[model samples]
Target: MAAMATWFLIVIYLAFISLGLPDSLLGAAWPVMRPDLGAPLEAAGMLAMIVAGGTIVSSLASGRLIDKLGTGPITLISCLMTAAALLGFSFAPSLLWFALLAIPLGLGAGAVDAALNHYVATHYEAHHMSWLHCFWGVGATGGPLLISYFIKEHDSWRAGYTAVAIIQVALVTILLATLPLWKKVAAQRSMLRASSRPHHSDASVKGSNKFTAKTDREEDIRPSAQPMRLPGVKMSMLAFLFYCGVETLVGLWGASFLVGARGIPAETAAWWISLYYGGITIGRLITGFITLKVSNRILILVGPLISALGAVLLLLPLPGAITLAGFVLIGFGFAPVYPGLIHETPVRFGRANSAKLIGYQMAVAYTGTTFLPPLFGLLASQAGIGLFPVVSLLLIVLMLLCSEYVNRAIKRKYLIA
Candidate 1:
């Protein structure tokens, strides 16, 4: 059983890496793909928005899907969807094909993200959660470099999509082989649930399944059900919203800020941006160890404070080295907040309700990813890229405030210490 559990962890980590493989591919390949397809450069944003919209819709529906279909099928089908979309990208002849394909790509990515996050949050230790996300960072970083290589070697952006699709297909095969593993785990959890509620009759379990299936929909997604009436749910959603906005704004615009505002060369700025993501990966590694000595709340508080300090550093009239240090610090500071919030969800809202809350949280987070950075882009266009630091600072402040409210709400309503 222990060995099986370890293998489960390994497969999950691999899945996470697969999840990230295509995340940044569009951005990296757009320079080449756009010219070949005869699309305007700005058209990339439309495609991105289309993908984000699909992700938002899928994530919002994931609670019901994951509850009914289970994680194994959800992960399997999501990866297959992503594989199909990537294959579509590889052969797309025009912008219309790319736009249409973005929908499934987004849906697959969002469902996989929400399902895996909820799974790890419920079943694993915080350290494993941290490490799992680090693996995602590994894939996110590798995708661009891999795509860039393909574009360089073959002078064809299609090769990048083809290579990633092959990798995703390989992952889907592994997932297929691991079906029994997921089944075993589900069986164990069901048994535990039955034993824990020995007094409940079959009717109760049936009712629970029905209730959970509709929780996200009736309470959150549907118009009649007041999800905000649920304790801690609204705060969690808003906190995730701000957190994602802070992270995305920095990632998407950091290089441009360095190049345009600080007068750093584009090549050097890109290198520093890589270091920023490296900081996030490394920080999560360190955080996995630090979880032994600290609580999730402390990590959440300390992280944003450190990130705020980094934002302040960027705001200062400093040398290039200091600015680079600021970027790294910001990344490091952001490392723990996401996983920490996720791991705390079950504790904050009973396990019975966590699935719905997590689904809503993911939807809100993706929505933040979709719209907030674009708003910042408009700001940068009007106010200059130097607005990066100020905008980051503002987002960080909002994140911290949201975290505080969430913490207080959980403590007051849920009594979660």
Candidate 2:
């Protein structure tokens, strides 16, 4: 059983890497694809928004779908959908076709993201959670390099996406083979719940059996009796919103900011942007080790504080080297936030309610991802890309404030173990 669990986790880690594969491809490939497809450079914002909108919609519905269909099937179907969308990108004739393809891509991404996050939070250790996201960072870092290489070699962005689609198709085949693993986990959880049911302290009838057939069937059909109607959940969502906004804004436009504001060469700017993601990948690797000794609460608080220092570095009137250092710091600072918050979900809320709460969190996060970066694009168009740092600083401050409020709320209202 232990070996099976380990193998299951290995598959999940690979799935996470696949998840990150397509995420940064657009941002890296866009500068080249934009002119080729007759798109204004700013139009990337619209593409991002479209993708975010699709993610938001899918995330909002994932709880119900997962409840009905289970994680294994949802993951398999989402991967296939995403693969199809990537194929669409490879063959797209214009920007409109790209926009149209983003729908299924977003839908696929959100479902897989929510399903896997909730699954890991409930079943895995904090270090596993951190490492899973670290793997995602690895894929995110790889994506741009792949696109950059293909563009340099073939002068065609389509080649980059086509390669990604092929990878996704391969992953889908792996997922299909592993379907039984998800079912095994589900069955084990069900039996555990059954074995513990009769021991409920509040049972009214002495020597009563809570693991009746009817009870088992009911639980299998619907796990949570009540929705996660909690007070601190709203603040948590707001914090996620700001964090997603900050991360997306940085990833999507960081290269543009370097080129337009600092007069960095395009090749050098792309390298720096990849370096920024590399910082995230490396930082998460460190974060996974840190989790062995540090409490997640303290780590969560520390991440944004570090991020603030990075934002200040960006605002400083310094050399391009300093600015590059600022981005690296920012990426490192953000490393622990997303996964850290998620790892705490089952602790903050009971396991029964976690799926629903996480779904809502995913939706709000994507909403921010959908709108904030494009808004930054518009601001940069008018006020110069210098506004990038200012906007980033403000968002980081807001994220920090929200985290503080959430920490306070959770401590005051609930006992977290």
Candidate 3:
């Protein structure tokens, strides 16, 4: 069973790769793609907004879908949808086509993300959750590199999209093949949990239907049926909102902060931002090992505090080297927070509610990803980018406070650790 679950983890990692592949392809290829489609470069922002909107909607609706269809079918279908969308992107002759394709692409990506996070959180160890997300970072980083290679060598962004689309197709095939692994593992987990508790965690396939069957009339989807009014739920949303806000703010403004405040070159600042993402990747790798020993609550609480230190480092009147190191510190600190929070949702909220709350958490996280950085940008424009570290520190503090509050609320009311 462990071995089967481990193999399933590998498949999930591949799906995460597919998830990451489409994400940066648009950004990297948009420069060349825009001219070919006769679209303005700024239209990328419009397409991005469209994609984000689709993702937000998809995430918000994932709980119902996952409950009915199961994670395996959701994974398979989501990957297939994304694969088709990406292939369509390769053939899109106009920005309008790209806009249309972005919808399914975003929806597919969100379903995969939300379903897989909840699946891993409920089924696997804390370390696996951290590693699962690290795979996402791997995918995110690989997309740009893959697209850049096609542009540099073939001089065609279309070829790049085709190449990535082909990869997504391959992952879809793998997902289709491994549908039973998800079923098998989930069945085992459900039985074990049933033995230990009284019919909790209905993350299994409902009554022998292989793929997508319209099975409704089951009341197992809701743990409480009213999780929205819970203090822990609200606090979790607030924490994710602030946490993701801090992360995206750093990514969007790191170079700007260096250039505006520290008088650094754009090229050099880009290198430092690379270091920042590198810190996140490497830090997640280390965090995988760290979670073996530490609890998610500790990881979540400490992550922001460490990020606060990084923000402090940026705010100090330090040397350029130290300021650059601050970005790495921030990235390292951020590494464990998101995954830790996701993994703890089941423990804090209970497994029966994991799907729904995780969906909410992811939706709010994406909402933060969508809006917070830009909101901070508005503030930065008014006050100058010198407020970079200052605002980051403030957001980190809010994230930490909300996260800690949720932890305590769960412990007090739910008797959860």
Candidate 4:
């Protein structure tokens, strides 16, 4: 049983890692698509926002669906839908069609995000959960590199996406094969629920055969206690929103900042983007290990401050090496925030509400991820690309404030020293 559980987790992690491929390709392919489609920079930015918007809507809806329907159906549906949407995107003829297709792509991605997150939160240990995100980081980094290779070969970005669509189809097949494992966990949960009910009378406890299947059914009909509400679930939700904003801002716009603001070549900008994700990948692994030894408050409070400093350095007229260092630092500093928040969510809220809480958190975060960066793009267009770092600096400062709030909440809840 223990080995089976471990194998189940491995499958879940693979499914999640696979999900990041599309997002990575989308980010890397933007520069090529913009020129091909005669899109303005803002239109390029809008492509990202449209996909994120779909994710936002679907994440919120998936939470309720997961609670009512369980993870198997949701995961299967999401994987199939995401595959179909990617196929649609691969064949899109115009910018308008591509943008429209992003909606279903986002929905499929969002559903997978919500369901997988819920599954891990409910079944996995905390340390393992952190490591699960590491797989996502791996996928995020690999996606861009693959796209870069195709772009170098003068291949169509459409072909790159077609390849991803095929991979998604295989992922769906693997996930379907693993459906029975999740059902076993669900059955265990149901048995646990049945065994925990109260006895009607003292006599019932003394092997009274009168307390039979009918009596058990009567007790099962009663509502269970509401899941334990985290003391600061609302505040944590807000922190997640800010974290998402920062993550998306860096991932989506950081390359543009390099190209438009710093005058780096498009190819160079894409490489730098990979470094940003690479930093995240390294940081998440390191932070996950660090988290096992350290408390959340220290990491939460200190990480953003380090990232804010990195953002400040990037804003300056530094040398290329120094600017690259800034991106690395920003990546490292921002790395632990997301996984840490996810690790804490299940600890704070009981497993029953984990999906809904994470859904709400992602929905709010996607709002910032989807909307704010385009506004930043417009700002850059108006004020100049040099303002990009300055804008990021301000967001980092806001993130610092949010981190402090989270720190205080952790202390109040006795989650930290």
Candidate 5:
């Protein structure tokens, strides 16, 4: 049983990493594609928004499918769809075709995102869930680095997509093979426990009859069929709104900041963008290891403060090296916030409500990602590149304030440790 659980986590982690690769490719390859596709700045920004929008809508549908179909089948479908979409994207004849492909890609990615998180939380230990997310960070970091290397070598971006497609196919095969083993292990464990205990089926029947009236009354007194509202839900939405803002801001604008603001060469700026995600990658792994011991509330509070400091340093007239350091800190600071929120959802709302809560959370967050960066880009186009960090700093402040409120709300609920 333990071995099966361990292997299950490993497979989930691999799927997450594989899932993140295409976005990383697009992020790193954007500079190259913009000119090739003759896309304006708005169109460039829309590329991300289009994909995020698709994910947002698909996630809502995915939650219900996950409940009905279970994780293994849903994961397989998502992986296969993702591979097909990437291949379509690779051969796209025009920007329109590319945009069209992003829709399915987004759907696949979003389905996997919600399904995997739910699976890990329901089936695995809490600490292992953290580790599973760390592997997601690993994939996020690898995407850009891999794409950049191929571009530098003058290889086709299509090759990158092809490689990821192969990986996804292999992951699907491995998961299908191992799933029956996991089910068998679970059944055996249940049987072993059953053998050692007096059967309670008859007692349960008698107790159920006695509790029938009480059960009806309890149901009447229970909260409405509407999802239980968490005090933090509103604030968490705002924080994640800002979270999407910050993450997309950095992912979309990091290279732009280096080139437009710092006067670094284009290729050099792309490489520097890797540094930001690299910090995120390392930071998530560290957070996963340490979060079990540390106060989650304290960690949440501290994250924005660190990120705020990074934004301040970026706003200064510092050397390129120093500015890069700032981005590194920002990446590390931003790393744990989103996953932390997702982790806390089940903790705050109970497992039954988690899918609905996460569905709404992801939808709103993607909406922010869709619009916020373009707003910054507009500011940059009109005002100057200097406004980028200033805007990000303001959003960080809002996130910090919301985090404080969210902590208090969690304490009030007292469901989570």
Candidate 6:
């Protein structure tokens, strides 16, 4: 059983890598792809919006979907769906087909992301949650590298898409073969939950999460929590909104900000921005190890301070090396936040509620990705790119406030318990 569990986790890590594989391809290949399809450069934004829309919609619905289909089936189906989309993209004749393919691509990604995150949070150690996400970072970072290499080697964006598609298809085969492991593991998990159900004391039962208020104590009143119908739900959503928004904003505009405000060369800015992402990837690896010794609470609370420091550096008229370090610091600081929040979900709320809440978190995260950067873009157009650091700082502060408040509420049992 232990060996089966390990194998299942390894496969899940690969699935996460596949989940990220197609994501960066569209952005990286768009420059060369657009002309072939007779599309304007600006059309990339529209396609991106379409993809984000699909992802958001799917993430919102993933809880029910996974509840019905089971995690293994959902993951396999989503991966297959994503692979099919990439295959279509490889041969897409026009921007229209690309847009059409983007829908399934987005939907596939959302389901896989939500399912695996919730599953890992419920089934594995906190450190595994951090490590699995680190694997995702690997995939996200690898996608662009693959695209670049394929484009350079074959001089066709189609080649890159095809290569990624093949990789996904191969992964799907491995997933199919591992179906028995998922079944056995899932059965074991069910038994474990059953065994643990009777072990809770009165204090724990206060947080039992009936989904409807039945307890005499439920009348004690968390007036604000009633609307969301869950304790900590609102704050969790807000935290996701700000964190993902900030993440998107930084990645989208970091280079532009460096060029515009810091007087860095465009090429140099791009290089440094790549390192920012690399910092995230590397930092998550370190965070996984850190999780072995440190609690998620400390990591979650401390991470934003580091990010804020990075933002302050960006705001300062720092020298060249310091400016670069600021970006890296932000990336490293952000590394543990998203995954830490995820790993803590089952802890904060009951396991029965974690799936739906995580689905909501995923949806909100995508919404932030979908809307925040563009809105900030509009503001930057008027206020100047120098507002980058200011905006980033504000977003981080909001996220940190939400996180800290939720933690306090949980501690006080002031949340929906």
- Best-fitting candidate, measured by lDDT? 2
Candidate 6, residue 369: lDDT: 75
Candidate 2 lDDT, 1-417, residue by residue in tens: 557777888888888888888788777776677778998767888888988888888777877898999888999999999899999999999989999999999999888888887677556554777788888888788877777777777777799899999999998999999998897975665565566643322111111222223323433345455544553677788889999999888888887777777887555666677777888899899888877666566777888888788879888889988888888888898998888777565455544566667677777888889999988888777788888888998998898788778667655653331
Model 5, CA-based lDDT: 0.71
Q: TM-scores for all candidates?
A: 0.80, 0.85, 0.74, 0.83, 0.84, 0.79
Error of 3 at 68 (Å): 4.5
For each candidate, what is the lDDT?
A: 0.75, 0.78, 0.74, 0.71, 0.71, 0.75
Cα distance off (Å), candidate 5, residue 331 = 1.3
lDDT of 1: 0.75
Q: Candidate 3: misplaced stretches above 4 Å?
A: 24-46, 87-98, 147-163, 189-226, 252-275, 312-324, 346-355, 374-391, 407-417
Lowest lDDT 10-residue stretch of candidate 4: 200-209
TM-score of predicted structure 5: 0.84
For each candidate, C-alpha RMSD in Å? 7.1, 7.0, 7.9, 8.7, 7.1, 5.4
Pairs in clash, predicted candidate 5:
none
lDDT by residue (1-417, candidate 4, tens digit) is 557777777788778777677776765677776787787777756877888888888887886888787788788888888788888878888889988888887888788887887676555545565577777777777666766666666667777677778888998999888887787975664565467663222121122222223323432244225422445666776677667777777777777778777888666667777777778788878876777666555666677887887898897888998898898888788877787776555334433455556666777778877877778778767787677677777877776676566545544644331
lDDT for 384 in candidate 5 is 71
Q: Write the per-residue lDDT of candidate 6 for residues 1-417, one digit (tens) a residue.
A: 667777788998998888767655665555456568997544655676677788888777888998898889999999999999999998989889988998999899888888887787667555777778777777666665666666666777787788889989999999899867776886776676666653322221234333313322333222223335655678989999999889767766776687667776544554566566667788889988776666666888888999899989999987889988898888889898998887666556645566557667877889887787767767876787789899999999999999888777665664334
Worst 10 residues of 1 by lDDT: 200-209
Compared with the true structure, what per-residue lDDT tens digits does model 5 show for residues 324-400? Answer: 88888888888777777776654444445656677788878878887888777777778876677898899889988
Candidate 6: list runs displaced more than 4 Å: 26-45, 90-95, 150-158, 189-232, 253-274, 313-324, 346-355, 377-390, 410-417
